[model samples]
Target: MNETLSLFGLATTPLELLSFVLSVVTVWLNIRQNHWAWLFAILSSGLYGGVFFDAKLYGDMGLQLVFITVSVWGWYQWLHGDDTHERLPVTQLTARGRAVAALAWLGAFAVLAWFLRSFTDTDVPYADGFLTAGSLVGQVLLSRKRLENWHVWIAVDVLYVGLYLHKGLLLTAVLYAMFVVMAAIGLRAWRRSMGQHGQASATMVLK
Candidate 1:
């Protein structure tokens, strides 16, 4: 056990430490509804992208590249997507939207799993595909200011904690543990903001 732990530590090294720190900052910025959160997220994702490649988590490594592009889109959306120059409003997904998102998740998972199983020696192809697909959905929803994004994040992040631990990546496991807590906080905060926005919209309608 000790030897396994030491091996994981060697994999982490100093760059992973920097990635961990940046990830924390990214989550903090996200909680504050800052557009710059995406910038930090991009940096953190870029660092971890390489780390996952080394760890043979090919799906996650590829997801980080997608995250970079999404981060740019997110930054733009948060800044200019709203009409009043305000930060993007937190809103829940509609029923139709939820249905569509579910379909996307399923499709992505199936395709990714097949590709990974065929092309890579990944040990847990389905698990990796599922988490990666779910995370992609969460990131897209988050970029669009969807309140339900945190729920998806909380679920997948919990799974990731166990997955990383099983893979013997202790530090990455710890990072996901922190992500779980942050996701909870983000859910509460976004829900509160959504309530406030709803009330304000109601007031405007009355006027």
Candidate 2:
């Protein structure tokens, strides 16, 4: 632990500090249902993408590229994808959607695990695969305004905290810890927004 702390240097560097600040803002914006959240997501992902590459977390590095693309898609979806001419509302996933998501997660886990084991010198292939798959699902769900995305993030972030710590990425471990708390807050806030939307819809129907 002492050695790890020395490596990250207590987050004193400008890039480290900036990444932390951007992550906080990204979580806040996500809670608020703000489209600008994608912008911050992109920025945070780009910074951490480089960090992951430097650490030789190639799966995570590739995931960041996917995140950048998803951020762009999410930005567009939040702005104009809804039929009501409003930002996409927070909503639960359909049963079919959940089933599909599960299948996707399984498939991704298999593929990523095999790829990591064969192509890289990673020590924890299964853990990397699990987190990578979960993160992909969470990101996709988030892009579509699915409230369960936060739940996925909460789970993934908890695992990520330990993973980063094991990998000697103390700063990233700290960030994942923050992510867990922020995901809980985001879940509550988004649920509240969804409830508000439900009430509004009911009122409109009665009118």
lDDT of 2 by residue, 7-73 (tens): 3455334555566679889988988888899999999888877777666788888898999999999
Worst 10 residues of 2 by lDDT: 1-10
Query: What TM-score, computed on C-alpha atoms, does each candidate reach?
Result: 0.92, 0.91
Count clashing residue pairs per candidate: 0, 0
What number of backbone clashes does candidate 2 have, counting pairs of residues 3 or more apart or in separate chains?
0
Candidate 2 clash pair list: none
RMSD of 2: 3.1
Query: Per-residue error at 29 for model 1, in Å?
Result: 1.0
Error of 1 at 135 (Å): 0.6
Backbone steric clashes in candidate 1, count: 0
